[model samples]
Target: MRLLVMLTCLLAGCLAEKPHPCESPPLLTGALTVSTQNEKLWTYTRFMYDALGQRIRLMELGTYENKSFSHDVLALFREATMYEISYHNRTCKKKPLKTDFQPLAIPKDATLLGQAVLGSSSGPGQGLLVNTWTGDLPGKAGKYMNTVTEFGCIPIATSYQTSEFGWAVTSFFNNVIGIEDPGLLNPPDFCPDAEMMDSKVEPIDFLSLFHGKA
Candidate 1:
C-alpha cells in the first residue's frame, strides 16, 4: 500500500548516518603503542605534538631483535633539523629532518569507512562514538587508515603500510587536549654537543621513526 511505502521511506531516512569532517586539536600530548607486521617490532612512545608550530617530541622505548632501548627525539620542521638523544649512552645525534610536517587532521580526500560505538550504548554516557577513515599517504607513498572520536576528533588508532616498509599500527591513548609545557619540545642541553651528521646523507623519515624504522 502507498501508506506502507511512505513509512518505510521515513524510517530509512532516520536510520541513515551522516559523516562529519573533523580535525584534531592543534596541540596535544598522548601515549602511543606501535607494532609492526608479524610482531616484528613494538614500541611505547610518549609524544607532545604541536601541529601549528611544526614540531614534535617523542620519548620511545622499544624492543627489536630482542634488544630493548630507549631514546628521545625532537623534530623541528621549521628548522629542518632533528635531534636524537640516547639517555642510556649519554649521546646525541643531530641530523636533517627531511620530511614535511604532516598535520593531525584528516585529509580532505579521505573516504569515510563507517561509524561505530566503542562501548555499550544502553544508557546515557555509556558509549563513545567514533568514525573511521582511509586515505593515501603523501606522494602515494603508502596507504593509511585512522579512527577518531566523533565529537572532539581525538585520534584512537592509525595504521600505515608502504611499499618499502611493512604495515604498522599505532594506538593512541591518554590523550590530553593541549600541551601543558611548551618547554617539552626543546632539545636537551646536551643536544648542542651532538654529533652533527652530514646533511647530504639520507635522512630518516620523521613519521617512520615511530614505525620501528629507527
Candidate 2:
C-alpha cells in the first residue's frame, strides 16, 4: 500500500488540476441534472436538494424514457463538498471503481491544462512535480483526493504493484502513467456538469504557471 500510493503521487501531476478562481460562485442552491442509463451520457436524474443546499434528500423519477412504464430511482451518491478555499484541500480518497472499457480519447497535448490529479496534496506537499487542486470533485468525507483524468488512468492499489499513480519516477506530464487505453472521445453530453478540461486544448491562462499570482 505504501509503494502504491507513492506511485500515484508521481502520476498526480499528469492528471491533476491547478486551482483557478471559478468564473462565478457555485450555484450551491440549484438543481443538479443527471442521466438515467449510462454515466457517460445523459444520466437519468430528477432529485431535489435539501434546504442547506446539500444533497441530503432524493426522489428518483425514471429516466425520460419513451414515456413507457416509469420507475423511481434513488440517489446513492452524496454531496460531500461544494467549493474550495485553496489548494490546501483536495486529495484522492475514493477507492478504485473498475470498469471494463478503456478510456477512448487520449489527449495529444497533455500540457494544456491543470497540473494535478484528484486528491493532489497542497503545493507544500508537492515535490518538483506536485500541484494544488481546488473546487473540484468533493472526495469522500469532504476531503480532497488525487484524481485520475481521462487521459491519465487510475491506478489500482495492489500491494504488489509499483508506487505512484503507476509511472516511472520521470513520467510527470510526459506520457500517461496508469491509463491503458484512452476511453471515449466524443462522449455523450452528461448534462450541465463541470466538464473536465480536455488535455488536448490549452486554456488561455496556461501561461499563468509562470506569471504572478492572480
Candidate 3:
C-alpha cells in the first residue's frame, strides 16, 4: 500500500508539470482588431514593439452608436515602466496605472492547441489555450480559459470570455502592417502623470458594445 501511494504521488507530480510543446515566443506588434461573432467592432488596438518582444504602445480605438473613443498606453521597458491614458467617454477620470512592470512572457499554464491558418497573413501559427482565473465563466468560479491565435510568432487573435457574458473573441486584430510612428510611443502633454506610469489599464467591454447588433 505504501509503494502504491508513492507511485501515485510521483505520477501526479508529473501531470502537474506537463511539458510544453516547443514553440517560438510570440512577437506580436501591430494593429489588432477584436470583436464578437457578428463583426461588431469590440476593440481596435495598435501595438508597437522594439527588437525584443516588449510591447511599446497599445492604442485602443472604438466607435459605439456613432461615438468614437480612444485610449492608449505607452510601455517603456528599459525604464521598467508604462503609462496608461483613458479617454473617458462618460467621465474624464485619468486614473494612474498602479501595477509594477515585469518582463512579458507567455502564461505558464498555457497549452498549445495546434497550428492552423489564421487571417490573410502568410505562414501558419500556433494557438495557446490559457487557463485563466477570472470571474467570467458560469460555475467556473471566475476561472476559465481561452485560445490565443498567433501568426508568424505574433498574436493575431483570441477570444476573451467572462461569466458576465458568454465566450467570444472580445478582442482581436488582423492586417498587422508595420509602422514607424514615433509619436505613438510618447504620452501626450495633457497626460501630466507620465512619471506615475504603471502596467494596468481599464478592461474593454466587448459584449456590452455589441448589444442589439449581436
Please tell me which predicted candidate would have the highest lDDT against the true structure.
Answer: 1
lDDT of 3 by residue, 1-214 (tens): 9999999999998887533322224344456665544443456766665435344566777764455666566655445444555556322223333333332233455545544443433434443433221223334444333333342333433455554444445343453435456565655665654344222644222243232121
Name the 10 consecutive residues with the lowest summed lDDT in model 1.
205-214
The digit string of per-residue lDDT tens for model 1 on 1-214 reads 9999999999999997687667899999999998878666788999999998889998899886567867688899998888887767767788888888887878889999998999988999999999999999877978899999988999999898855438878899999999999987887776777766876767778555664344
lDDT scores in order: 0.83, 0.24, 0.45
Candidates 1 and 3: which is better by lDDT? 1
Name the TM-score of candidate 3: 0.46
Model 2 bad stretches (over 4 Å): 1-29, 36-44, 50-55, 64-214
RMSD (Cα, Å) of model 3: 11.0
Per-residue lDDT for 68 in model 2? Answer: 22
lDDT string for model 2 (69-163, tens) is 22221111222211111112322111111112112122222222344434445667453332222222112222222322333232211011112
lDDT of candidate 1?
Answer: 0.83
For model 3, state the Cα shift of residue 187 in Å. Answer: 2.2
Ordering by TM-score: 1, 3, 2
Instruction: Please estimate how well model 2 matches the true structure, expressed as its whole-model Cα lDDT.
Output: 0.24
